[model samples]
Structures are given as structure tokens and as C-alpha cells.
Target: MIQRDHIHMLIQINPRQSVAKVVNLLKGGSSRVIRTEYPEIEEFLWGDSFWGDGYFVESIGNKNETVMRQYIR
Candidate 1:
């Protein structure tokens, strides 16, 4: 879901991948696309970074998938 200043995504990834790596890939890839496609965004950004320095992550394990998905939605 997309909001004014943030987005909620329910992503399922391979178990071997670290959350940090996934987050980095998502942020870096999207940042490049947004910057390249819409250079005007630079004016609203701080320095050279597009995303914030920190991210929030939660592990739902085996039982709370439905709850998490509902929360994100």
C-alpha cells in the first residue's frame, strides 16, 4: 500500500537472504530508478540519499502471516 510518505509491502523472500540485503536492494534499486526517471526529486532529498538510514522490520515466523498482512494493508 502507498501512503503520502511511506509504503507498506508484504514480501516473501528466500530464507537464505538477509533482511538487510533485501532492504538495501529494494532501496538502492528504487532510488536509482526514481532519481533517473524523475530528477526533480533531488530538491526534496537530503544530500545523496533517497531513503532513510534506518528501516523497521518484523519477523512473523510461521503463525502471524495473516495478522501481519492485515496490519500492513
Candidate 2:
């Protein structure tokens, strides 16, 4: 879900995939699309990057899947 200043996503990653790599792919890919589709965004940017430098992640178990999905929603 997209919010005013942030977004919430509930994703399940493969065991071999690193969270950092996933975040990078998501940010980098989305940045390209967003910038290409809306060049006006450059006016509001403070730097060269579209996304912030930091990200927050957490690990959830099957028992808490419902709770996590609710939180993301």
C-alpha cells in the first residue's frame, strides 16, 4: 500500500535471497520507472537518488503472517 511518505508491502522472499538485494532491486527498478514516467519529480528531489538511503525490514513467521499482512494493509 502507498502512503503519503511511505509504503507498506508484504512479501515472501526465497531462503537464498538476501533482503538487502531485494530492497535494492525494488528501489532501483521502481526509481527508473517513476522517473521516466514523471520527470517533474526531479523538482522535489534533494539528491540524485529517488529513494531514501535507508530501509527497514523484519522477519515474520507463519504464526504471525496474518498479523503482518494486516499491518501492511
Q: Which one is best on TM-score? A: 2
Pairs of residues clashing in candidate 1: none
- Number of the top-ranking candidate, with lDDT as the measure: 2
Where is model 2 poorest over a 10-residue stretch in terms of lDDT?
58-67
What are the per-residue Cα lDDT tens digits for candidate 1 across 1-73?
7788787888988899999999999999999999999999999987989988888876778868888889888
* Candidate 1 to truth, TM: 0.82
Q: Cα RMSDs of all predictions?
A: 1.6, 1.2
Q: Which stretches of candidate 1 lie over 4 Å from their true place?
A: none
lDDT of 1: 0.88
lDDT of 1 at 31: 93
Report clashes for each candidate as comma-separated counts: 0, 0
